[model samples]
Target: MQKGKIGVSSDNLFPIIKKFLYSDHEIFLREIVSNAVDATQKLKTLASVGEYKGELGDLTIRVSIDKKKKTLTVSDAGVGMTSEEIDKYINQIAFSGANEFVEKYKNDAQAIIGHFGLGFYSSFMVSKKVEVITRSYKDEAEGVKWECDGSPEFELTNVKKERRGTDIIMYIDDDNKEFLEDYRVEELLKKYCKFLPVEIAFGKKKEWKEDKQVDTDEDNIINDTKPAWTKAPADLKDEDYLKFYKQLYPMADDPLFNIHLNVDYPFNLTGILYFPKLKKNIEVQKNKIQLYSNQVFVTDSVEGVVPEFLTLLHGVIDSPDIPLNVSRSYLQSDSNVKKISSHITKKVADRLNEIFKNDRKQFEEKWDDLKIFIEYGMITEEKFYERAEKFVLLKNTEGKYFTLEEYKNIIKDNQTDKDKQLVYLYATDVDAQFTFIEAAKNKGYDVLQMDGQLDSHFINHLESKLKDSRFVRVDGDVVEKLIPKDEKQEMKLSEGDRLDLTPVFHGQLPQRGKANFLVTFEAMSENDSPVLITQNEFMRRMKDMAEMQGGMSFYGDMPDNYNLVINANHPLVMRINEDKEKDLEKDLKGMKSKISTLDKRRAELEKAKEGKKDEEVPSAEKEELHDVSNKLDELKKKKETLLNEYGQKNKLVKQLIDLALLSNNMLKGEDLNKFVKRSIELI
Candidate 1:
């Protein structure tokens, strides 16, 4: 027997490894199994290189849990370490400063992950004592047994003859006795070794015999050894990718399509990214992109390695260049990782462009599923947008799909207004905004379907990118004003008449929550819609953006203001004016007399104080002016009250307002029911 202290500068090594080396206690199993795999792979390499002249026997790595013994053993058939190698690799902790090492690599679960040659030490996290029985492949090497009891000290001695391999045995501690359970060990193996290249044997396979299930003699292998991503794309069919998707996410919906990535020169990267059938809630589908290093599972949260927009995709990204650590800091600084990200972006854009050019019908078939992803990429990645601009599609209300340039060319002649601004008409809902859509269509113009999860943000981005282009929702304005085919028509109604009608309509506006209405009269042609509801584009966009993002919540809390545009050229609007003139002519005459007298007195008082400072002006003149202003305010109130009374008694006013509200889909619940009943009663 030989004895010596561990090769380390400090005696507090065990405490450091126990408390801070790994982020999760669950990772102990992955480390040990990874070490066993490394050993098995090394033996295979040695045998292939003529270093060993022995039978390349079974290369399986076995995991066994002994309940009564409270021990979990990971045994591998590979190049095991001899006594001297054990002393150097196991006994010697080749670390400079434990604190600095832990701090530098703490965030990265992969940095200290398979490093430290201390894959064996991770056992100390869950074990009270760990024993290693290893036999080197060398002809004259003696089998050795090394044991440690969660301390710096260790015992080494000769052991009985065994195969040329190593068996790591761990005695589960009181706090971690759960590792001794069969199901727990099985779950850990499935999590960390499900796609490992080597064969991992957890336990004997079972079969359902006549009366009950029976354990068979066959060893239960937990991993695939060769996942679909590692194979050639030519060998995989569409169903194969779907099958692999089901294997990765059994409960998820079938993916729309997949992009097989196999690049070597710039940076070695191979994986299958699936365009998941992303439902409405985009937040729940994140973190599904698993990151791996040489088939060893690293993490699923690959925010730093992948471009921000690409995070919306679901699949696996396996690269040796990416760091293997809980903290992904290593990848954040790796030049290779940056190149890999750029390559991935290029590949995704290339695939989309190819799909758009080759099978546009299929692309259109899946546009709803693909729109959000394309929009996100365009909004976030500048380079991606450059490539995507050619293939990004727009489906108009006519159900025809056109690329950005295609749609621009088709509409350039007709959609460009007198100011040379290219107007892009769009509708959030084709059915709800059907009236507006039809109006725009009737003008020989196209209206796009902008109903999407990210369309609001996408339109904002598009407007910024496309020069002289403006995205106008179909319902944003009246048909003529939407494209501004000719200069805006002047309002024919007199200013006094507008003021008189404004109060009448304003008093009858809806009393819904935070719902304010602005009454505007447009001299649209008689053929145009009698009434239109237009929301301010800026305020509406702010609220839509606020729903998706934070810090703009003030806009979300503000009232929803809409324009109650009454077409003055329409017959109903003209009749409303005629009725108002006949009903309020007498009241208007009396109010005008009172208001004119007050205004004359106020003008005389103001003239007395003109060109004079407050100290120079007489208090009597100021008091007289104030009295006149009060009388004017009283007369205005009387006029407003009379207008409200006229509006209340007029059915044309209520009928027109309700019809406009119904057209905009703003009348809901009780209001909608009342509108239906009112329509019946009027008919």
Candidate 2:
């Protein structure tokens, strides 16, 4: 027997391994099982190279838990290490400067184990004592046993004869006795080894006999030696890929399509990415893409491996080039990882373009489901945007689809405004904005349906991409103002008439929740609506963007601003104008005469004081100027009050305002009831 301490520079190595080597103590099982698999694969390689004449029998790895004894063992039929090989590989940890190593790698335990050959020592994280029994494949070799008790010291000695393989036995500690549970061990195996290259058996198969589960004679294998990602793409059918997708995500809706990625050039990468039917809540569907290294599951949180937008996809990505235990910093700086990400983005764009060009009908059928993902990618990744622009679609209110260039060409001749800027009118909801949509259609203009989750951000993105273009919601303004032509029409009402009618319209505006309206005039045909409700395009867009992104809360806190545009050419507005002139003509004319005399006196007083300093100006002149301004303000207020009183009594004024409000889906309850009763009385 030979006993000695592990060749490490620090006595704190065991404690560090236990406390900080791995983020989760459960990963010890993965490390140990992976080591067993490495040994088995090495033996196969040697046998194929004519280096060993041994029989390559079943290389199944077995995991067994003994609850009573508190021991969990992983046994494998593969190349075993001899005494000399064990001294070089297991006993000596090759790192120097123990203090610096601990300081640099304290927060990264898994990275330490993977970088420095410390796989076997990971068992110390959850075990009080670990033992290894092995027999090399060499002829006339004897079995050896090695044991350690959570300390630097270890014992190595000769043991009884055994097959050419290895066995790792771990005595679970008091705090980690859960490792000794059958269900716990089985769960760990399923998580880390479900798709491993080697067959792994947890226990005997179970059967339901007399309403209770009982062990059967057959061994229960917990891993599949070959998963769908490991095979050639040509061998798989669409149904096969779909079946594998169902296996990965049992409760999810069927994926729209898939991309089979197989690249061996600069780096080896193989995986299948499925486009899941994503919902509006993007955060809920993240972390669904599992990452694997040589068929061994590594992580499901692959934000670092793939582009941020690509994480919305679901499936598996297996690459032998990526290290089994990679650190966050390493992932960010690795060239291979960057290449892999770029390649994946390119592949996805290529597949989408292929489908779009070959079968556009099917593509349009799936656009409603695919729009959010495509728009998200366009907003996040610049390279993806460049490739995706060719296939990204623009769906119109008529349910017809067109690409960016195609739609631009179709509308370039008619939709270009006076300033040469192309206007792309869109509706968020067809039913809610039906009036506005019909108005646009009546003018021989096309309106797009931009109602997806990411359409707000996507519209902004397209504006930046498509030069000399801007997107406006159909309800953002009146049809004439949305794409104003070079021609202009004179207003029918004079400035004084407009000023007198402003308060009349303002008094009839509804008191909706958090919404403010500004009375304005637009000269349109008599056939148009009497009153139109429109929001400013830029302000509305800012509010919508504020809801989708952070750092723009200021816009969200502001009240909704709408424009109450009264058509000057409409018969109802003309009647209101005529009625106000006829009823308030005497009062308004007298008030205007008084206001004019006060204004003339104030103007003369201000002109006399303009050229003189305060001391030179007479005190009487300043006092007279102040009195005249106050009198003028009072007269104007009186005139406005009279107009408002007359407006409140005019049922036509209230009816027009209510009609506009109802069309905008803003009039409710009492106001709607009042409008209905008023309509019946008018009829």
Leading candidate by TM-score: 2
Give Cα-based local distance difference scores for all models: 0.83, 0.86
Model 2, position 589: C-alpha lDDT score:
84
lDDT string for model 2 (1-683, tens) is: 99988887776467776555456778788888988898898889999999998898989999998888889999998888788877877788745544566566544444643321476788888888899999888888889898999777889999985698889999999999888888889999988888888899999999999999999999999987888888998899999999999878899899999999999998899999999887766554567998887777778888878898999999999887764332211233367678899999999999999999899999999988888899999999999999998999999999999999999999999999999999999998898889899989998999999988788889988998889999989999888899989887677888888898999987777777799999999988787888999999989989988998799999999999999999888888989999888888898889988988888888888889886889998888878888888888988899888888888888999999989888888788999998899999999
| Candidate 2 clashing pairs, residues 3+ apart or interchain | 21-109
Listed per candidate, the RMSD to the true structure in angstroms reads 2.9, 2.8
In model 2, the runs with Cα more than 4 Å from the true position are 97-117, 324-332, 596-627
Candidate 1 global TM-score: 0.93
Q: Would you give me the overall lDDT of model 1?
A: 0.83
Q: Candidate 2: lDDT over CA atoms?
A: 0.86
Residue 409, model 1, lDDT = 97
